[model samples]
Target chain A: MTAVAAPTRRRRQRRHISPVVWLFLLVPAAIEVGLVFWPALNSFYLSLTRWNGLGAPEQVGLDNFRELFSDGVFREALGNNVIWAVGFGGLSVAGGLALAVALNKPRRGVGVYRSAIYLPMVFSLAVTGLFWRVQYQPDGTVNTLLGAVGLESLERQWLADPKTALYAVLVAAVWRQVGYVMVLYLAGLKGTDPSLDDASAVDGASAWQRFWYVTWPQLRGVNTVVFAVTVIDSLRTFDIVWAMTQGGPYHSSELLSTYMFQQGFTFLNLGYASAVAVVIFALALLFIITYLVRTLKEEVS
Target chain B: MSAPAVTAPAPPAASPSTSHDRQRVRRRGWAFHAVMVPLTLLWVAPMAFVVLISIRGFDDIAARGTAALPDSFTFEGFRTAFGEGAMGEALWTSVQVTVPAVILSLLLASMAAFALSRYAIPGRRAILLVMLAGNLLPPQILLIPVSRITESLGIYDTLVGLVAIHVGFGLGFYTFVLHGFMRSIPSEVTEAARMDGAGAFAVYARIVMPLCRPSLAALGALATTWIFNDLIWAITVLRTQAKFPVTAALLNLQGGYVSNWNVVAAASIMAAIPTAIVFFAFQRHFVSGLLMGSAK
Candidate 1:
């Protein structure tokens, strides 16, 4: 015990290690500072100035804020984004959990279904965007099928209708995203105790009762993560919208992502774009922090 | 797509061979098949349409419309997409950016993760959370600032700049996942090697690294897909069209060539290839990696 204590005491000695470890640490940290932190600070500065990409930024100091408040387009996009968050974030999690719970059994050919469902997730967002575009065309397969079912009157330009376009995009988004969530929830489901399930089964519980009483509570930790992730993700979606309509005929499908990109790049309203970016940054941070706090509180209790 | 739902479990005591059990099983089977048929069709329709339209002759597209099925298939779209030299050029550009970006990010992130796991690093967990937090931030916020910073560094509008941008963005998440994996390994293995007179470098070279093979595989696959698929970032940061990777090149094709559905389908399918290949090749690891990291 004394000898072990002596080695432990010796562990406090200044062991002058080689510089490689510091080199490892500093390289990644330096890139973060340069690319992420430095620019984050610069974005804040640029947000206060009224400048295009090339000119010297004149400090307008919250004048941009005044203009942004009056901007009808920005408000419309903001409302669309909130709708987008609920549709994409809420639906995908519920769908994914339902799928994962359904397939948690050791069924034959389950892996085949899993792979087929996940296959779409492997497609590039650009491709998904294009694919959805094809499906949304006036004479596309979706309309054609609906026409065959004698719902031709219901067939409208899916992506052209401002009210329906974002939701149409959500269909494709859910197609790709649900597999990702399902796979995560499946893994979470794996961690649940089989005996508990068996005991519940022996206690004459129906499947719905078992799920509500046993499965959901056990899966809460995973659900918390999936919920936060989906919300952040839905808010940040860009490629799909950009590929599909670029915020579309009336800005009905406009998300903060597409709006910021257009403002920053095409319009060169860098300051305004930066402010939009900051809002997105804040919302994502809020979701992540809230989830983390909830999880941590659960741990403490 | 909803096949997971078709696999409802019943208690083992309720064997299906019993007549009543058989009746119930048969009913469930038919209901399962009925549900899956349409679901699978809905899921598979988009890809099928793209492929169907891509091979349709231009005359067929003109006569019927972009949505119409081909009377006879042709390779014209693929030929046009590849032969016109646009996609081919884009392919070269994508390879130039993606290969190096994926390799370098994985290498740097793994090395950093190794060091983070092995050493008594200061502010380790906090550093990891910062990285993870960056992952959640919308990439739109970083576009303008990152572009300016790269321009000041004299690499904006270049492929190396694109690679560096990817690395900077990717490092945090990759390092975070790899660190999580490393922490789960029992410390006794490292201690045992140390007691056998293994040096720090030797332990890493011989033990820790070999154990991290699965993680490296997952990271490489995921990073490849992300870099290959990324468009908005690459477009915002990279100005020169010649420097555009496949995604940007494909994106540009959309607005100017809205009427060219044949070409777009072909290009979109082409764009999905690298990711699909990487995905199927290492899918198990991909799922495991995502679940483990997200669970954290």
Candidate 2:
């Protein structure tokens, strides 16, 4: 049934005797598996003890969890991470959606405007946070601006007040993250069939009506992805908080990441930190799975 | 800011029978521009402060606050940051580790992606899933074994060790992503190249590499951002204080300091500049390719 193949004809298909390929593929994959498995497993082992990471670790199972529940600092850090998730993940998406819509309409200088908005997304979180630390100083620009605008009564210590500190970080966080969300939405918007908008417009639909009814539905999948990623990034954030306040004013701005670092390295409490790492891994995994499932469904459909 | 008049989004492109309708579209376009410009400034306002703060003398930073312009502009903060035993060396340390990590991974990932995308290997899909999972797992979970693994190999405090870790973690996501991009390059082109007796490497280097420029640039920028700003692994694996990356140098600006805000601010802008430069340089390819891949 198949084309009759001569013996020499089959043999003449050049041999793919490439040994280097095996080395290239297997070597990196092996390194990753080894690195990922070892510490992840070690963290679980360490979590069963009371190791300060320096000396002998006492084998005291469940005590760390027990103490963690009672620990005021851990509770505060958890609260702060939740706040960060809402602020960075929730607020930034909303702001990014607003800005993306506003800028999506083509106009003069729109490219410059788009580029400027996305500028903060490229900045290291530490740099952005460091700059904001100066901005939040009692005698800082924020205060000066308030004074200049005759709102001097509202000016106060931004980072020092526990009530206001985490919010201040979120303000800067939103400034950095909104652009990222805008870019994602912009990409989705580009993919959108513009004819649908024109068709709806010809039917006497207002621009707002077309966006709400037509454009928003097309953007559903992208929105799901943005929400999930923003949440993960928010939870894993360490650099910014560490840079500006170091979880200061009595651990007020502390998130799980910064708290884990302080406990593991600074205080040499490795076992506890590993447990916290486990928590972070679980959370990130949950978000990623949701994103993958939704995106995969869209691909299949 | 001048866009060379690309003829991108013009109101005149819209069909208009009446001049009033065209006029209405133009007004909307101008209104949209009005809103976005102010929003963009609010977005970048904080970064503006950091650059300004980096140039001020220590006395001015203290006296006038971060918002106020320097009374006498000077490069004193820059001098302090690059002084002996400061972030200047750390910045170099970051580059030394980052460049090799990025280049080597790009090579390995291209090879792997080529094979996985083009072949009918039974385990290819499963292997890709496993690799993607490895990337999804947080880096904090890998720090302990990475540290001990480097120590056992006797390269824990060296730049080589850091490079190795970056390459290791980078492979999973890099390979997974590059495979998708390689898949997008139509198979007809590679088949034609094969007819010309081009070997695997030639096909990759000549045909595939040129075509996959967007993906490669995106991957390079992604890897650079990751390795440069990474604080956790840098501090964990590099025990010696001086071997610390600039990201870790930010930590040194910590401790119960006797009020060192100016130096901290200066060091921060220095550490952030390389990435910002890269962003500006590859802004188009970096944003479009990456956002397309992820959002798609």
Instruction: Name the best candidate (by lDDT).
Output: 1
Interface RMSD of each: 3.7, 3.3
**Candidate 1 stretches greater than 4 Å from native:** A1-17, A291-301, B1-19, B192-200
Candidate 2, CAPRI quality class derived from DockQ: acceptable
Give the alpha-carbon lDDT of every model: 0.79, 0.77
Candidate 2 lDDT over B1-296, as tens digits, reads 35444233456555544556656666766776577667667767766776777777778867767679767577777777778427888888888889998998888778777767655444777687677667667777777667778888988889899888887777877887888788788766886887898876777789988888878898898778878878777877888888888888766754423245566667778888898898888888778656744675
- lDDT digits (tens) for residues A160-247 of candidate 1: 9987898898888988998888888998899888788889988999979888898779988887888888888877799998888889
Clashing pairs in 1: none
| lDDT accuracy of residue A236 in candidate 1 | 79
Model 2 Cα displacement at B187 (Å)? 3.0
